[model samples]
Target: MSAKSTVDAKIAQGKRTVVFSKSYCPYCRRAKQLLKDANEDFDVYELDEFDEGADWQNALAEKTGQRTVPSIWIGGQFIGGCSDLEAHQRSGKLKQLLA
Candidate 1:
């Protein structure tokens, strides 16, 4: 499958939250920790660990218009990055989304 297809497939399969992250990005780490603290089950793909990482990232950028790591999706909807997740959590929308 193409990178874009792979990303779309992952998002469409919303049995769990999806996070496209870089292994070493602090924001990625924090976003993951937030999910963990919320006891949310998530699938995290560390793009930095993949050979096609850049392709995936580029595909994500094209789809979401966000070029940074920790590109997150919940229930097939783009949830954005760490700060965005934080906002959702703060507003209790995260819990609603996880449901």
Candidate 2:
């Protein structure tokens, strides 16, 4: 899909979603695909350009409380990494959050 369309869908959903990702991370790609498969949308913040500075990682860690790829926030709540997202999908809680 076009990037603009993906972004527009996310905005129209009216739920705050943000993904902090690194370009080379497989988990990040998986997380994005999961959301896409579910027909959900989200904003993504790339950290691939940043150096391994504590400030950058610490900010994410502060928000997520976990230093991992594909840190996802749903409506300002930390839903966790890729595995956690998949678990949420299995449990049907991810839909509830999106709703």
Candidate 3:
């Protein structure tokens, strides 16, 4: 399922919050932890578990222009990677987004 449609379908399922991440990435871990600490409802897709995770990431890069782990979406908006999420966390905008 390396097709762009597959990724599009996953993103379009209307899951209020989603995290495209890798289990081994510290940034990804931090992003998840931050969301967890905030008690934010979200689903995480561990890209590393997929056989074509790298290719999927490439497709994602083409889609969102982010080639990094912890690609986050809230209310169907791409909020960017770990650092961006953390910035939002610190700014208290993360809570607002979750709400």
Of the candidates shown, which would achieve the greatest TM-score relative to the real structure? 1
Q: Return the TM-score for each candidate structure.
A: 0.95, 0.75, 0.91
RMSD of each predicted structure:
0.9, 7.5, 1.4
The digit string of per-residue lDDT tens for model 2 on 1-99 reads 544344334434545777778878899999988988888877776667655433555566664568777778788677899999999999999899888
lDDT of each: 0.93, 0.73, 0.86
Candidate 1 lDDT over residue span 1-99, tens digit each: 999999898888755799999999999999999999999888989998989999999999999999998999998899999999999999999999998
Q: In what order do the candidates fall by TM-score, top score first? A: 1, 3, 2
User: What would the per-residue lDDT of candidate 3 be over residues 1-99, giving only the tens digit for each residue?
Assistant: 555777676777847888889999999999999989998778788899988778778888998988888889888789999999999988989889998
Model 1 score (lDDT): 0.93
> Which parts of model 1 are misplaced by more than 4 Å?
none
TM-score of 3: 0.91
Model 2 is weakest, by summed lDDT over 10 consecutive residues, at 2-11
Clashing pairs in 3: none
Could you give the candidate ranking by lDDT, starting with the highest? 1, 3, 2
Residue pairs with backbone atoms closer than 3 Å in model 2 (clashes): none
lDDT of 1 at 41: 88
Compare candidates 1 and 3 on lDDT and give the better one.
Answer: 1
